[model samples]
Target: MALAGLKVIEIAGLAPAPFAGKVLADFGADVVRVDRSTSTMNLDVLAQNKRSIALNLKSPAGIEALIRLCEKADVVIEPFRPGVMERLGLGPEVLLKRNPRLIYARMTGFGQEGHYAKMAGHDINYLAISGVLNERSKSGKGQVVDAAMINGVNYLGSFVYNMNKAGALFQTPAGTGQLDGGAHFYDTYKTKDGLFMAVGAIEVEFYKLLLKGLELDEERDKLPEQTDSSNWPKMKALFTKIFLGKTQAEWIKIFDLTDACVTPVLDYYSMPTPTPAPRLLRTPAKASASNEGSDVFLEVGGHSKDILAEAGFSEVEIRDLVAKKAVAGAGLEKSSL
Candidate 1:
C-alpha cells in the first residue's frame, strides 16, 4: 500500500535480484518482470504479485519495446554481468535519458568494474572473496551457504567494518568468534529429539537465567569464567550434554517469556506465523491472493500481448512483433498476433 502507485521493471535473473523485486512487489509496487524468451527454473514463489513478459532483447524491436516500457517505469532493476545491457543498447544512460527520474539499479556479483566483474559467481563465491565464507569453512569442505546474499550486504555495516579498520578483525576459524559458537551461551545445541535450539543468552543476567533454566545453578559457582576462551570447550560440552536431555519444544516452553534468549530452530515447513517486522502500527504488510490458474504459471512471455498493449503498442503492432518473434506469450493465436 505504501508503494501502490510505484512502477518497477525488473529484468529477471537469479535469487538476489528476484528477491529485491519480490520485496517491492510485496509492498504494493506495480512490478513487471522482463523475462527472457526461454524459461529457466520454476520460481512461482518469487513470481508472486508480479507480471512477466518475455522479450528477445537481441532483436531491435524487442529492445525498442523495452525502452518504451522504461519510458513509463520509475525503476529498472537489471542483474547481469558488466556491459551486458550496454552492449544491448538498453543501459542506464539510454533508459535514463528517456525517463530522467528513473532509478537504474544494477545488481551484479562482482560489480560493474573490477577484475572479477565479468567472472561468473554465485552466492557462495561472493561470500568466499569477502572473508565470510573462509571464517565459516570447516576442514576445507564447502557447506551450503544460506541467505549469504543478504548477509553479505549486512556485513558492510559499521560494527564489523570498524573492527576491520582497527586491524582487530583477525580471520578466525569456525566456532572461534564470540558470537560464532565460541561460547556455550551463544550457540545452538541439539535436543533429545534430534532437533536444535538456538541459545543467545549473551548478557550476564540472561546467561544466569539460561543456567537456572537448565538446573545448573548449583554448578554455576564452580563453572569457569564466561569470557575466558579456554573455558569455552568444557562449558560447551556441559551445555550440550544437558540440552540433549530435553526436547527443543520442552526447552522453548521453559525459556518462553523468560530472559534466557532461547528459541527452537524452525524448518521452512514448520515456520509459524511471523510477527510483522518494522512494527508499523498502520499500513502493515498484507499478503495478496496470488493470480489464479495455470496461465499464471506459464513461462516468461505469458503476458506479452497485454504488456505490449499497456506500453502503447497497437494491437496490430503487438501481433506483428509476436509474428516476428520479438516477443512471446502463451495463447497468442496467429490471427491475434
Candidate 2:
C-alpha cells in the first residue's frame, strides 16, 4: 500500500531486474512487465505481483507503445548491456526527454561507461571482480549472493575499493581473514546428526559464553588467546570435534536465549520468516502469493490489449498492432477490451 499510486514499467530481463520490479509490486506499485514476444525461461517467482504485456521491441509499433507507456510511468527499470536500450531508441536520454520526472534505472553487470561495461558477466563474475569472491570459508569455496550483481553494482560497495583505501585489509588466501573463517569462534561446524551450526560469538563476553556452553572452560588457560591467528586451526579442529558430539538441535537448546550467538544453519525449506525490522503497527510488511493461473509461467504478452488500451490506444490500433505481430496476448481475438 505504500506505493499504491506509483506506476512502474519493468523491461523483462533476467533475475535482478525482475526482482526489483517484484519488490515494487509487493509494495503496491502498479508494475507492468514488458516481456519479449519470445522467452526461453519461466521466471514465475520473480514475476509475482506484476502484470505482463508482450511486445516485439524490434518493431516500430512495439517501440512506440513502450514509449507511450513510459510517458506516464513514474519509474522504468531496464537491464541490458550499455548501448542496447539506446539502440532500441528507448534509452534514458530519449525517455527522460519525453517525461522529465521519470526515474530510469539501468541494471547491468558493470556500469554504463566503464571499460567492462559491454562485457558479458553474471553475479559470480561481479563478485570475483569486486574481491568478494576472494574471501571464502574454511572450505575454501567462494560464497555466492544470488541476484547480487544488480544491487552490488548499483548500491552495494565494491569491497576491494574500500579495502584499497583502508590499507589495513589485505588479500590472504581463503579462510585467513578474522571474520572470513580465520577466527575459530565465527565459523560453521557439522553436528553429530550431519546438520550444521553457525557460531558467531565475536564479542569477548559472547565468546566466553560460547566457551562455557561448549564446556571447554577447563581448557581455556591452556588455549591461545582468541585474537591469535596462529591458533585458529587448532581451535577450529577442537571446536569441530566437540560439535560433532552433539546434534544441531542439542547445541541450539544449550545456546537458546543465551549470548553464545550459536544457531542451526537452516536450509531453504526450513528457513524462518524474519520479522520486519523497525516493526510498524500500521502497514506492516506482508507476503503475498505469486500470481495464479497456468499462464503465469513462460507466457509473454498476456495483457497486450489491456495495457495498450490503458496507455490510450484505441481498439482498432490494438487490433492492428496484434495483427502486425508487434504485440500479442493470450486470446487477444476474444478479449473485448
Candidate 3:
C-alpha cells in the first residue's frame, strides 16, 4: 500500500473513470465517489471497497460542495466532454488553482486538446486514431475482436500506471501534471499451429534466443522492416515450424528462462495465474456493469462513519435510491476465474 495515506475524490461517470478511482482506492487511498443523486447503487465488482456520496452535480450548491472536497483531496477523477466540468465550474483550472498540489485527472475519449478533443467518440474511435486497431488486425480482414480489451487494458494501464509514476514529473518534491502512457511493443507473434504468441519488448536477447530456439540457420539474416512483404511468409513459416513441434507449455519452459521475451497467446480467461515475469498483484473484487460481471482491481479507503454521513443518506433516501436505481453497492458475485 504505497498510496495508503492519499485521499481522492471521484466524480462519478462510466467505465474507465470509475476504474481509475477504484485502482487508487484499492491501493489504500481514501476514494469518495460523488455519485449522481438519483443514481442507483449498482455496485460493480471494480467498485468494491469504495464508498459513495450521492449528490446532484447539476446543482450549484452540490458542485460547490465538491470543490470544497477537492481542496482537501490529493486527486480528483472526472470523465466528461472536454469542457463539461469547466462549464459546471468544476474544471481543473478552477480546482487546481484552489489546490496547486492536486492531481486533477480528466479522462476522455480524445485528449483535452486536439482536433478531435471536442468530437464525440468512444474506445474504438480512440484506438483507431492511435494506430492500435489497424495494427491489431491481420491482413485487413475486417474482423472485430475484443476491442474492449484494448480500451480497458490500455486505459487502465495509462491512468493507474501513470498515477503511480506521476510523482516523477514534478519539479518540486510534489506538484501535479498530466501523463499519457500507452502501450508500446506489446503484441502477438505468429505460431506454426496457425496460432500466435503475444510477446512484448522483443528485446535483443529475446530476438537472439527466438532465432536460436526456432533453430533458424545461424547465417540467415532477419528482416528489420515490419511491412507485410517483409514480415509474413518466411517469419510465419519459421514460427509455425518452431511452435508446431511443441505445445505451448513446452515453449513457455524453454523461453521462460531466457531473456527471450515470449508468452503463449490466450483469451482473457485462459491466462494463467502468476503469469510471466514482472507480475503485478492487486486486491481481488467482483464488479458488475451493464449486466456483465467480472473480477477487477480495487483501490479502497479508510473506514469513516462521518464520510458516509456526509453523503447525507436518510433511511428514506437510501430506500428510494435503491428503489428508483439511485444507489448501488458492490453488487457482484464471485467469478470462477
Candidate 4:
C-alpha cells in the first residue's frame, strides 16, 4: 500500500515494462496501461491491480491523448526503442514539460542508447549477450539420480550413514550432536527482549569472532576448549545466560557485520518486505535525444471513457477517437495474478 493514490501511465510492452507496472500496482499505485487499440497482445501476466486504456499510438489523436494522460500523472512507464517515442511525439521531454514533476521510466533490454538498444531481446537474449550463459554450474559426470522429495530424502540416508561412520557424528546423545542444536555455538538462544538469535559460529575463526562480539575475554573468562565435548554443557549454560543479557536488536548491532554467524531469528512481521525495483528517487526521466529508449508495443486497456475524462478529454472527443480507431472503450476481458 506504499504507492496508493500514485498515478502511473505504463506504455504496454513485454516483460520488463509491464513487470515494472505490475510491481507498482502491487504496491498500490494507480496504474493505467496504454495498449494499442488494434493489437491483441494481452499483458495479463503482470496486469493485476491496474487499469488499461487502448490507444493507437500510430495515430495523431492517440498521441495527444497519451500526452494528456502523462500531463497529470505521477509516473509514465515507456517501453520502446530509443526513437520510437520521439517519432510518435510521446517522448519524456514533451511529457515532463507538461508535468515537470513527472517520473518517466524507459524499460528496455539493452537500454536507451547502446549498440543493441534498438535490437530485439528478452531475458535469455540479454543474459546470453552479457555472457551469463557461459557461467553454468556443471557437476562431475555420474549416473543421474532425480527423484521426488519424498523419495530423494530417503535416498539421502546413504550419505548420512557415510558421515555416521567416521565417528564424526552422533558422538553424543540424540540432542547432543555437534550440528543438531547440541553445540552451544550451533543453536538458538533467547534474548532479553523475548526474541531469539540463531548462532552458527562453528568454524574456529567464526567462533573467535562470536566470542569477541560477545565480549567474552579468553583469559578472564577461562573458557573451556571449544572442541572439548566434556565441557559443552557448561558452555551452553554460559552462552544461554550471556545471550539473555541483551535484546535481539542489541545483539545484532554487535554481530550483524562481524562475520560471527549470529543473526536474529525474525518472524514474518519483523522482516523487511521487498518493495518494487528500478525506481527513480531523484533526477526523474528527462527529455533528451541521447536518453535510453526501446521499441516494444503491447496491446491492452479499457475503461477509456473514465481514463480519458481524467485526462481532460471531452465526451465528444472520446467518442470520436474511438470512432477513428485511435482509442478503445473496453478493457481487458479478464486479468489475474
Candidate 5:
C-alpha cells in the first residue's frame, strides 16, 4: 500500500528491469510493461502482478504516445544500451525537463562507456568481466580463460579438491565433513524468531567460549566428542534444540563479548555493511576527521565549465564552449568557471 499512487513505466528487457517492476507492482504500484511489438517474451513470473502494452518505438505515433504516458508517470525504468533512449528522444534529461518530478533509472552493465558497453551481455559476461571468474587464480601472468555457467560454479568448490588426495580421509561421503556442514559447531541453527544464527566456532578455544556464551558449559562433560563424525547427528539435534530457545538478538547479546565466531544469518538488504577490507600498514583509511559533507549531484552538463577550467581552459574558452553549446547547464552566469 506504500506505493499505491506510484506509477512505473517499464521498458521491457530480459531480466533486471522486469524484476524491479515486479517488486514495485508487488508493493501496489501501477507498473506497465512496455513490450516491443515483435517481442515473444511471455507473461512470465516477473510479469505476474502488472499490466503490459505493445509499442513500436520506431514509429513517431508510438513515440509520442509513450512520451505522453511518461508525462503522467512517476518513474521510467529503462535498461537499454546507454544512448538508446537519447537516440529515441526519450532521454532522462528530456523527460525530466517535461515532467520535472519523474524518476529515470538508467540500468546498464559495464557502465555507459568502455568496450562492453554496447555489447549484448548476460550473467556469464558479468561474472567474467567483474574478476569473479578468477577468484582463486594463482597464476600471475595473463592467460585466456573460458567457462560455461555450470563449469564456473563447479570450480568454486575447488577448496574441497585437496581433500581428494587424503586417501581414506577423502573417502568420507560428500556433505558429511566438518567444513561441508556435518559438524554442529560449523552450521546454522534456527532461532525462536524464525531467523537463523550461524555458529562457526571451529577452534577448540572458540568452541569452549561458545558453550560458555550459550550457557551450555555446565553440560560440556555430557556432550559428545566435538570432532567425532559418528556423533554429529546427536550433536546437531542438541544444538538445534538449544538455539531455538532464544531469539537471534538474544544470542547475539550473549555471545557479543565472547570469542565464539557466532553471527546471525541476515537477509540481503538487512545485512550489516562491512568495512572496506584492504588496509595500508601506515596510512590506513579511517573515519574522516572533517564534519563537512560534499554531495553534488549534477545535471548532464552541470559541471562542463568547471571541468574545462580545471583542465586549464581560460575563462574566455569556457564562455565560448557554453556559447557554442559545446558545454551545457551554465547559462551566462556571472560566476564564470
Candidate 6:
C-alpha cells in the first residue's frame, strides 16, 4: 500500500505517462514533476499531489538541474518521441549512470525502437500499431480509429502503456524491460443484465466459473467443458455480447458476488468504493480557482520558451493542448463524458 521512501521524477508531460507516475506517487513515492519553466500547466490533473519544479530542459542549467534531481530519484518518466530526451541531454544513459537502480520509464505511442519511434504519436498510434485499436472497432461501421478517439485519446486511457511501465519497475533487465510481458488471462465479459466485467485469473477453474457465471452457450457446448483450456473464443464472444447489452451496474451486482475474476468499469466520478487512483486522490472536489497546490503538465510539441510564455499563456496553452484551444483547466469545468 505504500511505496514508502521511493522517489519519482516525472518529466512534465501528458496524461498516461504522468498518470503512471501519479500512481506511484500516491502510494508514497516522492513524485517531483519537472515542469517546463514556461509551462502554463496551472491545472494539471495528473500532476496533482506531487511537487513541481519548473526547468527549461532546452536550457543547459535546466537539464543539469534535472540531472541533479535524478540523482535522488528512484524513477523518471518521460513521454517524448524516441530521441527528444536524449536530444535534450536528459536521456536514460545519463540518468541511469547517475542512479543505477532508477527506473527510467520512457512512455511513447510506439516503443523505444520501431519504425514509428521517432514519429510523434499518442495512445491512438500505440493501439493502432498493436492492432488493439482496430480490434475494438472492427464491427459494423468499422471505424478507422474509434480506439484513437476513445481509449487512445488520453494518456490514462492507455492501460497497456501504464501496465507495461509498472511491470518494468517491478521486473529485471532494468529500464529496457518489457511492460506487457506478463500472464495472459486478461479478459472482459458481461452479466445477464448486460453490464461488462473485466476478468483476470490464471487458474483454470476460475476461468470455468467465469464462463459458467456468464452462461456462455458456446463455452457450454464445448466438450470437456469444465477445463480451462477449452476454446475461449466462443465464451469471449458471448462475453462481448453480454456486456454490450446492459449498463455497468447490473453486471457489477452479480460479478461482485461471485468469486470469479471480474470488476465493473468505473469512471472518475463513479468509483464504486473508496478508490486510490492518483488523480482522484489529489484533486480537491471543491478547490478555489487560485488554489496554489494544484498543478498538471500539458504537453505540446514544437514550441520555444518565448512562444510558450505569456500572460494569456495558460488559456492559450489550454486551448492549443485541448480541443480547439478551449481553456478547460484540468477538465474540472467539464462534465464527465
Best by lDDT: 2
Distance from true location, Cα of 149 in model 5, Å: 14
User: How would you encode candidate 1's per-residue C-alpha lDDT over 145-220 as one tens digit per residue?
Assistant: 1223424555665587688579655345767867767878889999999999999988888888888999876365
Per-candidate local distance difference test: 0.76, 0.77, 0.56, 0.72, 0.65, 0.54
Give per-residue lDDT, candidate 5, residue 159.
Answer: 51
lDDT by residue (144-251, candidate 5, tens digit) is 122223334446645555555555244667678777678888999999999999999989999988888777763655877678889998888988999999999998
List TM-scores for all candidates, in order.
Answer: 0.85, 0.85, 0.56, 0.49, 0.43, 0.47
How much is 126 displaced in model 3, in angstroms? 3.5
- Cα lDDT over the full model 5: 0.65
The digit string of per-residue lDDT tens for model 2 on 188-279 reads 99999999999999888999999999987747558788878888899999999999999989999999899899989999778864332334
Q: Between the candidate structures 2 and 5, which one is better when assessed by TM-score?
A: 2
Task: Report the poorest 10 consecutive residues by lDDT, candidate 4.
Answer: 140-149
Sorted on lDDT, best first, the list reads 2, 1, 4, 5, 3, 6
> Which regions of candidate 6 fall more than 4 Å away from where they truly are?
97-101, 131-268, 273-337
Report the C-alpha lDDT of model 6 over 106-183, residue by residue, as the tens digit.
666655665665677654565566533232123422111111222244454467457557862335442322222222
Give me the overall lDDT of model 3.
0.56
Quality of model 6 by C-alpha lDDT = 0.54
Worst 10 residues of 3 by lDDT: 175-184
Tell me model 2's lDDT, rounded to 2 decimals.
0.77
TM-score of 1: 0.85
Which of the predicted structures, 2 or 4, would earn the higher TM-score when compared with the native? 2
lDDT of 2 at 63: 93
Query: Between prediction 4 and prediction 6, which has the larger TM-score?
Result: 4
- The total number of steric clashes, by the backbone 3 Å criterion, in model 3 comes to 24
